[model samples]
Target: MTEQDVREVLNGRRAQAARNDGAILDAARTVFLAEPDAPIGAVARAAGVGISALYRRYPSKEALLATLCLDGLRQFVTIAESAREVPDPWEAFVEFLRGIVDADVHSLTVHLAGRFTPTPEHRDLAVRAGALAAEILHRAQQAGVVRNDVEITDLPMIYEQLAAIRLGDATRLRELRRRYLDVHLAGLRTAATSYGAMTGSAPTRAEAGARWNRTT
Candidate 1:
């Protein structure tokens, strides 16, 4: 074959490969978000790609999930950073909490992956996001808006509960979820405090993973 013809063919193949990679990632995100433990074959089917093609791009389900988890973490960091810029610390904290739950609802698989088996990159991103969340939480606490006993780790548990709201019927479900979330947020306010100290230890990653695995 002529050199020019060979070059054209190579470029065509590269474009096809890139398209396949994008399709695989998009499919994985959708399939896994609905069911975090979905099998690799399900993702391949969703991508409309052969199993071999999917395997070529991601050696294992874990590898694909890790990538998704990392992306989700980065998105979360962006949201938290943006919320931090809000003029009112209390508003920023409330918005940050809501944003995390929204993210988890859209990317359930990433949420589960981070808690269960995070890659090194995912872990690093989680740490960064956690630090940002801590800062937002601290600001609210210092403002005497959030309860003094609230811990940073308690944030994930709140998201977890929020995520439990069924989304099968989108419109009605969202309204119900919003109501529940509003009630929960109101409870988090410092004025909601009654008398005694808040009980229980802050949630750990290991415990979070165990709880997630139990549900899935």
Candidate 2:
């Protein structure tokens, strides 16, 4: 009933409002990505809020949609880390390569994937991913399991082709890409004269490089 109590009540309301708005943003993304034309009620249901409450904050469904797409890319980057678990460096590289292929053709680089520019934070994450691949490739090469001529930075382009070919023909694409990777890896494993034979003994810990444990 007092002035101080009234102020506290208003402040609490404002805080709750902000939290509701944030929840709407998150829920909007999930709803639309799950089904772009999903009803407003669906968004409310997904958000654990009411339909009226959703509209009260975002007047237009379009506004809510735009927010969803804008936020989707960050989530994509977060999901891309699932490919980093393979232990062998060459296989680890393949895991990342295949992941990019799926991402480009199916999600992150696809139409509804949203235009998430590479921010410094995102770019740094990308750098870490690439560095991890390179380290793995280096180790694989040292183990005589991969080609020595391969460059660590060439991974991105390899993935692009893999995705494109896969989209065009899934079976042939996998065969060709796998063959190319095997041959490329073979070359990197040994000298041109030796034809990159797998002459090394059991893989040494040092030759495996740092184990990839991508933070999701």
Q: What is the TM-score of each candidate against the true structure?
A: 0.79, 0.41
Best by TM-score: 1
Judged by lDDT against the true structure, how good is candidate 2?
A: 0.56
lDDT of model 2 at position 80: 43
Predicted candidate 2 versus true structure: per-residue lDDT over 124-194, tens digit per residue: 55556555666666766777766665665455445544444433364666676666655644444445536
Q: What are the root-mean-square deviations of the candidates from the true structure over C-alphas?
A: 3.8, 11.9
The lowest-lDDT stretch of 10 consecutive residues in candidate 1 is 105-114
Tens-place lDDT digits, model 1, residues 108-214: 54345443465577668778988999999999999999898888878777776877776667677667767787988888899888755677788876775453342
Q: lDDT at 88 for candidate 1?
A: 98
Q: How many residue pairs clash in each candidate at the backbone level?
A: 0, 8
**Compared to the true structure, candidate 1 yields what TM-score?**
0.79
> Each prediction's Cα lDDT score?
0.78, 0.56
lDDT of 1 at 95: 82
Error of 1 at 62 (Å): 1.4
